[model samples]
Target chain A: DVKVTQSSRYLVKRTGEKVFLECVQDMDHENMFWYRQDPGLGLRLIYFSYDVKMKEKGDIPEGYSVSREKKERFSLILESASTNQTSMYLCASRRQGPEQYFGPGTRLTVT
Target chain B: DQQVKQNSPSLSVQEGRISILNCDYTNSMFDYFLWYKKYPAEGPTFLISISSIKDKNEDGRFTVFLNKSAKHLSLHIVPSQPGDSAVYFCAANIIQTGANNLFFGTGTRLTVIP
Candidate 1:
């Protein structure tokens, strides 16, 4: 079985604070993704990394950045948290295919 | 401008009944489709998938039917259980520059009554 783990299951941050969400996969997948899910807006991609040090902006990448220094870990950074940034963040990984495995999401709340 | 759409926001079914979730896409370039189930506070998990070449795919009690001409697809769950209650999302595979990414629907919340 494939396991994808997220650093935090729940988090709360004040406005203008920096936040980090980490994800790690044991499958050594080549592609990793970050997405924020909202009530009426499904899972919108924030960023994705295809290889170490290589990143691409998804549909909604504003105010967010990602790091993939190693193949097994991917981190999402909120430069300065805001109320609008509060959402359910999800991380996924796949090995050069369309089938993706997801980790338990991190529910982030910004006050 | 939403490429993928799930017209129904929610559905309710009784246990031992069939539950059908529908999805539509505007992009004709999509060749692969998938269904995912998500519970509150959890990430979406892959349920089943179908390719454009095939019209139907089934796994255990879950089955997916695709209509290429209409660019639509549906997932049917037989003998629905209360544990099946969750948000179901439909996604399509889009290839961009040799990379395949999934474009997802807004999702339909399914509730099963015991």
Candidate 2:
């Protein structure tokens, strides 16, 4: 079974604060993704990394950045968090196959 | 623009009844479609999938029917149980694109009352 773990299950941050969400996968999948889910918006891709240090912007990449310095870890960074950035964050990892294993998700509340 | 759409935001059914969830896609390049189930506070989980070449796929109580001509698909859960209640999201990907990204729908929340 593949395991994807996130650094935090819930986080509360103040406005204009820097925030980081970390994800790690044990499967060594080359493909990793970050997504935010909001009511009536579904899962919108924020960023994705296909390989180490390789990143691509998804549909909604604004106000967010990603880092993939190692194979197993992927981090999502919010340079300066805002109230609008509060939402559930999900991390997923996939190999060459179509199936993507996902972490439990982190619910971030920016006050 | 949302390439995949689930117009229904929510559905309710009695326990032991059949639950049908529908999804529509506007992109012709998508060759594979998948359904994911998500619970509150948890990430979405892979539920079922179907290839464009095949019109139907079934596993246990879950069956997925695809209509290529209409660019639509449906998921049917038989004898729906309370545990099956969750948010169902339909996702699609283009195999030819070789990109691992998948287009997702807004999702429909299913509720099964015992």
Candidate 3:
């Protein structure tokens, strides 16, 4: 079974505070992705990693960054949290196919 | 620019009735289409998918229909159950030789009243 897990189910942060979201997948997949889900905007990709220590920006990657030091772990960092950054953050991992398995997701509230 | 669109914000249907969700895409290069179901506070799960080469695919109660000429697709759920209530999202992918990326629509909230 493909199992993906996240660090937190819910979090709260103040403005300018740095926030980190962690994700780990049990399967040794080659691709990982980060996305933010808003009410009207749906799920927009933030960044993706094809391999360890390799990363690429997605459609909405302006205020966020990602780290993939190991094949099993992927991290998303928010440089400075803002109210606009409050949303549901989802982590996904995919093999060489079209199906991407996702974690439970973290709901971040920036105040 | 929104490549994919789900115009309906919400839909309500009664139990045992068929629920139809629609989606449209602007880019003709998208050859693969997918639909996902997401409950509150949980990540979306893969529901079903169809390739551009085919017009329809069905899995039990879930079926997906695609129209290449109209650049549109729809998901039909027969005898909708209360447990099926959730947000549905439509996605399309650009199939490359060894790489693929998905573009998503806004989503439609489906309420199945018992």
Highest TM-score scorer: 2
Tens digits of per-residue lDDT for model 1, A1-111: 999999999999999999999999999899999999999899999999999999999999999999999999999999999999999999999997798899999999999
How far does residue B100 in candidate 1 sit from its true spot (Å)? 3.0
What is the iRMS for every candidate structure?
1.1, 0.7, 0.9
Candidate 1 structure quality by residue, lDDT tens digits, B43-63: 899999998999999999999
Q: Candidates' DockQ values?
A: 0.76, 0.83, 0.79
Task: Please give the TM-score that candidate 3 achieves against the real structure.
Answer: 0.98
lDDT (C-alpha) at residue B109 in model 3: 99
For candidate 3, lDDT tens digit of each residue in B1-114?
899999998999999999999999999988899999999999999999999999999999999999999999999999899999999999998775455457899999999999
Which parts of model 2 are misplaced by more than 4 Å? none
Better of 1 and 2 by DockQ: 2
Rate residue B1 of model 1 by lDDT: 75
Give the Å shift of residue A24 in candidate 2.
0.3
Cα lDDT tens digits, model 3, A1-79, are 8999999999999999999999999999989999999999989999999999999899999999999999999999999
User: Candidate 2 at residue B14, lDDT?
Assistant: 100
Clash list (residue pairs), candidate 3? none
The Cα error of candidate 3 at residue A80, in Å, is 1.1
Off by over 4 Å in 1: B95-97
lDDT of 2 by residue, A1-111 (tens): 999999999999999999999999999899999999999999999999999999999999999999999999999999999999999999999999777888999999999
| Clashing pairs for predicted structure model 2, backbone only | none
Q: Residue A89's C-alpha lDDT in candidate 2?
A: 98
